[model samples]
Target: MQVNTRSDVGGKAEAMDYTKEAIADPVVERSFRGHKGMVTTAAFSPSMKQLASGAKDGVVMVWNFRPQLRAFRYANSKSSSRSPAGKEAASPVHKVSFSPKGDIVASGGADKAIRLWVPNVVGDCSTLKAHTGAVRDVDFGDGGATLLSASDDKTVKLWDLKKQKFLQTFNGHVNWVRSAKFAPGGAYAASGGDDKTVLVWDMQQKKSVKALKHHTARVNTVAFFPSGNLLAAASDDKSINVWDLRTFELLQHYDVGSVVNEIDVHPTGDFIISAQDDATVKIWDAREGRLFYKLHGHEGKVQTAQFSPHGDFFTTGGGDGQVMVWETKFDRSIASIKKKMAMKEKKAGSNLEEAKPEEVDAKIEEETEAEVEAEVKADAKHEGVGERVQAKKVSISEPAEDAEREVEEAPSSITREPEVNENYTEAAKEEVRPKTAPSASPANPSSSLPSTSVSGEQVMSALGTIVNQMNSLMEVVGRFDMRLETLERRMDALEK
Candidate 1:
């Protein structure tokens, strides 16, 4: 099932260059195999030397990626040893993420609590609890001073990492918030949810400023590009939507023909990798809005895929209880350079073989240079194609013709009807209120009442007003109850 890279040979060469064969495909460099249950999520540290993974068994394991000091699992106590089988049960962990410095790791899951651990520490240093339902995802802020968690309770909460306390809660999605991530500079946060909407929140204002609705099904993941101005979202609708964060405009829509579970943008900002339910990962050229390569390896739904900080490698976790590390072919170019230098040295020491060492070295150098030159030429070709693709404005145009063509050519099972707008009307929008104190009522309420004319529009408007008032009252009540609960917890802490 491997594709041959020899077909795209470059210029004529005196000897057959085997370097191309060495880096033909993105072969698996390693497979992590300790999780007793499905690996729910995995992420590489900023240094790319360590990997943190969370599994259904609630174990958060950090691997050094080297053989000697292999891995350490966080337990309930101050010990890194494996928990006894008959001891306290472990909760299923849904997400694990490393902070920007890679010094801290966060995990959250079915326990409805978020725990923070230092990489080499034995147990969690702190725990934050607020979500009422299963926590679906967790992410660290830019400076690692704050953390964000998404939960099935339909809210995303920001926590102060230093204080280990809840700071603020964002409520916008009407359904479970599946994923939340801090923008590059941490000025804003983006969240996607079962409401089929992507929300960009103003962290300083503590409110949602923009809501981007495009997906037909639940949005599973949202990621901000490295520049922080482009945001990408993947969904169960079999499409990936790229938006310009500054303008909130849809920049590109790639219909992947399968349910996209997750997506990671390369650090170069030129490519995107999407893991799909079809057990395949597709790399797309961001500038061209076209497929660059397809990686096939996973056996079941690929739940997660992440590019290393340096973009030299990428990892994927699947439902089949496998985590695979893949080496990008682009990384091989650098290896080839080193290999070429070594070949020259080897040829110099091989005069006893009866071949002219200098000639052999010259021929090998020529072949190596030719191979590298060929790669450069191929890159130029891709760039030229990208320029042409951009010139056509395929990614920027509304109702992209190229995307439509892809959809038409796709199999029937992969194609579906386009999404229809289902946003609430103006009146319905007014019916929902922010979770804050209610305003004082007017003194002269009779003066605000409409005249006795009873048209259908008037009746509907009156009903909407009543609903809005009810919503405000309910929000007030809920806030009061939450305040009481907070007070109770504080009193208990004081007593302890």
Candidate 2:
């Protein structure tokens, strides 16, 4: 039997007029409605025959898209057994994701727990409780054996699906972690957070390998390209950054004109889609960094958008509590226009002057120097001694003049505390003093005195040296104390 791969849009168009008419009108095949609250997230199953949605009502609904639209509630057996007539989450659900094999689904939310469910099942849901704060997003690894979750607790945790046990916790973001996704092949995972940074974690090493810093506001979402050679980060700064994974360099930057809530890359690796706070979804040509389309239909902010597995359709969920599905139709006219635009850009680039190698190196060096100077100035103005110490540590690799300047501008308290501590001298003297008395001799009358008294000058010199070393050690301890205090405050807040 011959397989039918034709899309819902039919085939290529012959004229631009036909293409324009087709693109202007999008057919909504079906609208699935059951959630009592706003649908915060939605995803298509691996087979594209089902859809899973999560809402603020703390409920997850799975819809069968084939034959007819039927809804199924995913709830824990414990909760169902207690109240069989009711169906609702204990807290708001934030995210829902399907496993690679389509046999399982994971949902996490404000309850600070990840619940696993099998579609069409009424009860017996397994819950994984580890995060201290609201869980923002969850993603399955390539083989579906592991899962990654981002949480407001400022951590991204990895879990083993079979054992249902926590594997590792990635902690570096200073603010809430909003999104996490495993890279292709599952060797690395990328996470974005309210700290305005994107961290790439090495799964095997269990550590963050690279930090991508460009977003000026909270990084709301992150997605890796199909090839995993590039990673995209969307932020509240109204910009999306595409980073080259191999070199850890910024490849392209596209401004979406509003806060981006979520982002997804096309399976074809040719386009990227972003749901914006401005009640619109924007599509961009991923390779060229150019806007491709602006889809507008939602009455409120678009919260999430995703493409289907077959690449024939896409879905968008909004704050208005509506989910709209659109058909993906690539007509000949659209392709021709993109091709011409690419050629035009290539032709125009020859007239531009490109920077030489030396100029590029000089520019990088200048930027580095400016950043260091700004940090030093900021640290000097702040009253926190820990900040100044951190600045000093960062400037250790700078030129002698710069280091000396940092020391001169450092706060008087940090510089004088070591000198005021008399314990260092006393401790050194006590440690160096001998227990036995010296034998008296005719040639050496001074030997009759106690070691502490006879060698007072030597002891004083040793004390001074010990004091200097202790002062250095104290600086390190101060930094550690500052970090410890911050962690204590976080834990206390979580407890409350």
Candidate 3:
């Protein structure tokens, strides 16, 4: 379909150099199955209320995009009648196009005939015949007063629809012409063919203007960007190429990795869809030249894809003989923009000043340290309370003599501290270590002590145990901090 229009030739622009966002997940809204053979081509009406599809069975079907919007549909338009000589009357169809006003559905097929069907009413279709070879593609001009068709005749032809007469034929390709499109004002036309070339023609002059021969194989589809400044083509060479129309210079190349059968640019020039032989439909961001999503419902090679005129949805037909409709999900576009914005903010740029790296590191370190300290203090308080309750119970019930017994009962509690206290008690009993001890000046006048009075050395040793436990907590916090830093770095790298 033609991308450029009278107004909004200036469409949604994106920065091709920017970082790409994550691909979107696919969502199929509807599926229509009736064709007994490969569905070759499909197109959305300008109104988007109906969809027109043509298949190899020589049938054209018009379907309601939405169940609520009722319109006449031709579920099977192929004639079942056979000739007396036992020959099939119907010919394989290759392409279908909707008029600008959504009033007529035009289909071209192997019969070398273009049939115009009034899809909103039950009526006979009218045929317009001129080409001697099978028609491959057809499109309506700006005002729907004219039509363009590419065919196996090795030429692109323009016809006056209002007069129902052939206007002109531009010949250049030595092989079948596959696709044709009109520029913004319909003054110029572009066509791609099996000759591995894309040609731009001045329709008024009836001569070729630019010849793009970069494709290594048959060119399958071609389209002009909305502004008429760029044109894109897809080929069996497994690539899609964009050219600057003004300079006729190659601007971008996308290695699709599979034979591309058909490609269409969105009306806003923001997205493009490629139907590939891998049974996949690839959606790409036009400005960034990035593959945004891959749809995987068709069981056979996907042959045709086109966007709705409003750009909110698209439809695809495949060799499986089914057409699937999918919504683009505008919310995902906003999310992608937000993600790209975040990437820009994080990246170091001359125009965007960033905080000093050292300053950020120091700030994070300080916060982590504070949090660790608070957690350590809370653990110490809880530990002290449990210790005091255990000590009181031991003093009242079993006495200090059974402290070793209590330790044996709860082996999980206080393993090292009890052994240190035992060693100090043994030293006091021997009296050999008394000389290094402090003098007992506090017991000179008023002394209140039980039979077992703990020495000052034991208290110092217990305080050292608490310091050791705090160090262990700090090590645990350090490990956690390192892990968080690693995670943040990975996320930053992906965004860039």
Candidate 4:
């Protein structure tokens, strides 16, 4: 079936599609909406049942990848039994991912924290806080047992999910680390950072394997094909280069004619998807080194694109706040051959019982400990957000109140005390009040409510209405007084 994809501005999300040419096919099956900010990145789970997206609003939302309505829950919102998935509103999440074997997910953000999430759960799976700057990317390693995070702090952190402690920091990147990933074999991991270099690290040795440096500008993304033999790096220099993983040698270089934001190899190893600032996503024949399809529709920069695990569909997220899923015309002829090749690559005479029950228990205990540590970090974050929000509100409403209170108390410099006060205030309220914006209703004497610090802005904006109502009440009172005096004079005359 031919799929048609088109984008239009200021229309309902469903109604925006129109064919650019009469002969073109519609490419989108359905689009889902949930994130309140620009979707920075998205990935399909290995099972293809779920879609995860990270946004600048600090939210990492997981959506059902069904062709019909894909329901999602916000992470920080109240739980509803009717929703297909629960919300764990971790906002401003720069990246989100699912483990290869389980429903667990890892999300990293500008907050310099990494959070792991499990499906049907209400909160984070585990929280790792080691980076001092924004975490640029995160991924699962060692069959989702280990978590790897890259950050602007110029280091990549390896977290032991079982031990619930930071394993080690891969510290060779001279600039901010942009992306990292475990090779499909799980023996080594690759990281690309702002130093215009890619470093491969061996897990057992816990050191750098090789540093691949060729791009003249910052490397934005790096990916290893499922084969783990080929590495592709996208960069700000408008090029995508293929390299041999073992030798770290550049094999093929292709100019994308724009800043390449992300690169992904198809699971079958035949096609490559490169998202670019040119507002188009290009599919290339990875082997032939030629462009196959140029998918153009996004009105803004295309941030990232990936093929579904099944290879039948692909999705793209852009700066326009759109996530689009497209069907492909490619057949399964390549994938079937690769599957046969994979079966042959298994090592001969390996012990099948290497994984034991005790080992599994140990991993669970470690992840549990990591989860506990994450809970403490989340609580601290909740407190920090509350304080910042309160301070912003107080400043916007009446900073003088705090200043006056401070002067009256003759306290030490407020320091971060505003945050402490926010905690106390929330504890006293002990009620989750539904957040409200200023009401749109007009002000009148009949409905006159005294202006509190919170209502000052609303009261000022509606001051004219309040004044008119007060004038009307004064006029009524004036007539009542005159009528009372006249009646008293008439009674006195009658008495005489």
Q: Each candidate's lDDT (Cα)? A: 0.73, 0.74, 0.74, 0.67
lDDT (tens digit, per residue) of candidate 3 on 203-307:
889999989999999999998888888899999999999999889999989998899999988877877789999988877877777875666678889999988
Q: Order of all candidates by TM-score, from best down to worst?
A: 3, 1, 2, 4
lDDT, candidate 3, at 174: 91
How far residue 253's Cα lies from its native spot in candidate 1, in Å, is 0.9
**Candidate 3 local Cα displacement, residue 180, angstroms:** 0.8
Query: Which 10-residue span in candidate 3 carries the lowest summed lDDT?
Result: 4-13
State how far residue 325 of model 2 sits from its true place (Å): 1.8
Regions more than 4 Å wrong, model 4: 1-26, 66-70, 75-91, 121-125, 331-496
Per model, state how many residue pairs clash: 0, 0, 0, 24
Model 3 residue runs over 4 Å out of place are 1-24, 66-89, 330-332, 335-496
Predicted candidate 1 versus true structure: per-residue lDDT over 1-496, tens digit per residue: 2323222221111111233434444557888888777777889999987998887767888888877886888752222234577455678888889899988889888878888888884644688889998899999985899999999999999999888889999999999999999998899999999999999999999999999998999999998899999999999999999999989999999988899978888887877888889877777768778765667667788888898988888888877777878876644563576788789878865653555544444444454434433443444355332111111111212233553553343232121121111223443444443333457443576633543443577568667755754453344334333433443343344335
Clashing pairs in 3: none
Which pairs of residues have clashing backbones in candidate 2? none
User: What's the true lDDT of residue 243 in model 4?
Assistant: 91
| lDDT of model 2 at position 15 | 17
Which candidate should be chosen as best, given TM-score against the real structure? 3
Distance (Å) between predicted and true CA of 100, model 1? 1.5
